[model samples]
Target: MYKRAQYQIITERLKESRHFLQVVLGPRQVGKTTVIKQVVNDLMF
Candidate 1:
């Protein structure tokens, strides 16, 4: 499995608390959006 560090951390947090509000903060072009999108997609399936 090829997972980014941020992706893994966010995935674990989401699994721990599905209802919690998740905020991804960072400067431009840092893969913040990408991580959340990937996580959301994974959770859907």
Candidate 2:
């Protein structure tokens, strides 16, 4: 799981009014998908 600080940072960046794509990559089971889901959930469409 990502530390709260890091997750918030990414969330803040995504909140901006612009088209942005973030790519997360690492070894399998490193929580990349989990983090992406968290971000998507936190971000209101």
Candidate 3:
């Protein structure tokens, strides 16, 4: 499986901190959006 580091981090944060809002900040094309998309997809299933 292709594991994205950011994806893992986001998922972990979401699981660990349900009350806090998670934010991803970086330059363009740095996979911030992609990570969120992947996280959302995983959560759906």
Candidate 4:
């Protein structure tokens, strides 16, 4: 599967030792949920 650039960035941030708030901002109808779900699911297992 082809992942978006945002996916890599989000994944990297989440893998860090230090925690920080990551707010995803964008217009409506975008794949915000898709990216988030992909990231969470990938990290879950």
Candidate 2 wrong stretches, greater than 4 Å? 1-5
Pull out the clashing pairs in model 1.
none
Least accurate 10 contiguous residues by lDDT in model 4: 1-10
Q: Highest TM-score among the candidates is held by which one?
A: 4
- Please give the lDDT score at residue 45 for candidate 3: 98
* lDDT of every predicted structure (CA atoms): 0.82, 0.72, 0.82, 0.90
Q: Estimate each model's TM-score.
A: 0.78, 0.62, 0.80, 0.88
Of candidates 4 and 2, the better by TM-score:
4
Worst 10 residues of 3 by lDDT: 1-10
Model 4 has an lDDT value of 0.90
**By the lDDT metric, which is better: model 3 or model 4?**
4
Candidate 1, residue 39: the lDDT equals 92
Please give the RMSD of candidate 4 to the true structure. 0.9
Candidate 3 per-residue lDDT over residues 1-45, each given as its tens digit = 455788877887888845688878999987787778889999889
Q: Which stretches of candidate 4 lie over 4 Å from their true place?
A: none
Residue 17 in candidate 4 has what lDDT?
98
The best-first sequence of candidates by lDDT reads 4, 1, 3, 2
The root-mean-square deviation over C-alpha atoms between each candidate and the true structure, in angstroms, is 2.0, 2.9, 1.6, 0.9
Error of 1 at 4 (Å): 2.0
lDDT (Cα, tens digit) per residue for candidate 4, span 1-45: 768789999999989999998888899988888899899999999
What is the RMSD, in Å, between candidate 2 and the native fold over all Cα? 2.9
